[model samples]
Target chain A: MPPISFALWLLVLVFDTGGQLAFKAASGVPGEGLGHWRAMAVRPWLWLGIAAFTCEFVTWLAFLSVVPLAEGVLLSCLNMAAVMLGGRWLFGERLTARRLLGVALITLGVVLVGAG
Target chain B: MNTRWRFYLVGFLLLMAIDTGAQLCFKLAATHAAPFAADPGWLLRVLREPWVYGAIAGYLGAFVTYMTLLKHAPVGPAFAASHLQVVSVMAASAWLFGERLAPLQLVGAALIVLGILVLARAEDEVAQTTPGHAR
Candidate 1:
């Protein structure tokens, strides 16, 4: 497989994070059942989430087209850390020492796996 | 969606499993198709693979389940739980593709799980204790 490009993975990072935010926002709107979910289908936030997810899919496929599954997934783990940061910054979520250590370990894990 | 912890755990684990299956199918399709840059017909050929369809189906199921999960839980914990897919995929790769993780990779995988666990607990604490959480 060809090497995955930095730009592609970066795009995935952005899209994935954006998708999560959209979904979170969309979930706040009231919906009762499968039918009410149809109502949400038209909501902008949900649409945005779906759109971002669609972009993520395209970018992810492009990345996988070049990189091995293990490597691609290892790199993708960066999203978890990124999302945590985003939550703190955008949502006013607290980041305690434990969470910080968790993020650090995740980054360290990526390095170890990537090196291997 | 704003449900009890036990139900949330079950839903989260189910989503993770489906997500792993979807990714595995994508990998299978990618392995089968010629490189897109090398062959203009690659996308069309890839679409012909049953695994590609399976990937789409699996992804749709995950997406739907995830939308539901979003309501019952906060994004932080939900994402943290969903990321269990990475570990699931690692094991699935070993079982299905005969791939083996290096010792370093194994250690790395452990850290990933540990990190997610720590993050999950923190998120859960935030959700349950924060004001306006409505229990």
Candidate 2:
């Protein structure tokens, strides 16, 4: 509940959003002169994306060191909402009214679990 | 109960949410960015962006959380439960990005939510039954 921990959590969120964007950018590159596997393997951004994912896994382990499993998993689900918001804001992705409603429901569910 | 575990749990949740967000963002960014032309140096060019730093930071947090969680939690349940994020991402992607979702997928999401709720309740019951704990 300390401010520092909360701030850390927020940092995690931002980093996560950025990582995804990087991966997306990397994955979008079309095949260059290299063969399919070779081209993919050679992408610099893709490696960065993979590295980002590796960091994510490491952080997850660190978090687990301090939290109960079930509780951790429940809280982590909040990422869905964060991702949706990030996609809309950063990528200008569309969120239809229906999907927004679904997100709202999920948010409500998160609040319920958090409060409980 | 150690308060540290609670902190860890909250941290894990937040990171997971962020992780999901990152994936979605990546998908969108890929969609908008220009396709890779068959240039020789395109790969090198993509590697040098600032965004890559962000990804690294995110992944570091995730890895730490995972290690901590694995120490105390059942791996099977932990992973099985975490996969729900995939469903969450899929649904959000379809709804927000206009990606198609089959009716079955919708049902699957609903089922996942239901299962999670049930599991959450069950966890609470078990916690309550156990003695000498404040969590």
Alpha-carbon shift of residue A88 in model 2 (angstroms): 41
TM-score of B chain for each model? 0.79, 0.66
- Point out the worst 10-residue segment of candidate 1 chain B by lDDT: B126-135
Candidate 1 per-residue C-alpha lDDT over B1-135 given as tens digits, one digit per residue, 9 for 90 to 100: 444556676777889888998999999999988566556588788989899998999988998888887775666546755756766887799889999788997887798788877866665676667755611
lDDT of 1 by residue, A15-96 (tens): 9999998887787778677865877887898999889989999999998777777688778877877777776676655777
TM-score of chain A of each: 0.74, 0.65
Task: For model 2, report DockQ.
Answer: 0.03
What DockQ does predicted model 1 obtain? 0.50
Give the distance in Å from residue B11's predicted Cα in candidate 1 to where it truly belongs: 2.2
For candidate 2 chain B, which ten residues in a row score worst on lDDT?
B71-80
Predicted complex 2: CAPRI docking category: incorrect
Task: Using DockQ, give the best candidate's number.
Answer: 1
Q: Relative to the true structure, how large is the alpha-carbon lDDT of every model?
A: 0.77, 0.53
In the range A4-84, model 2's lDDT, one tens digit per residue, is 445545555555655655544453445533443365467775577567666777766666566665465566666656665
Give the alpha carbon lDDT tens digit for every residue of B50-134 in model 2.
Answer: 4544555655666445534433332222332444565667767777988876665566566556554544444344345654431
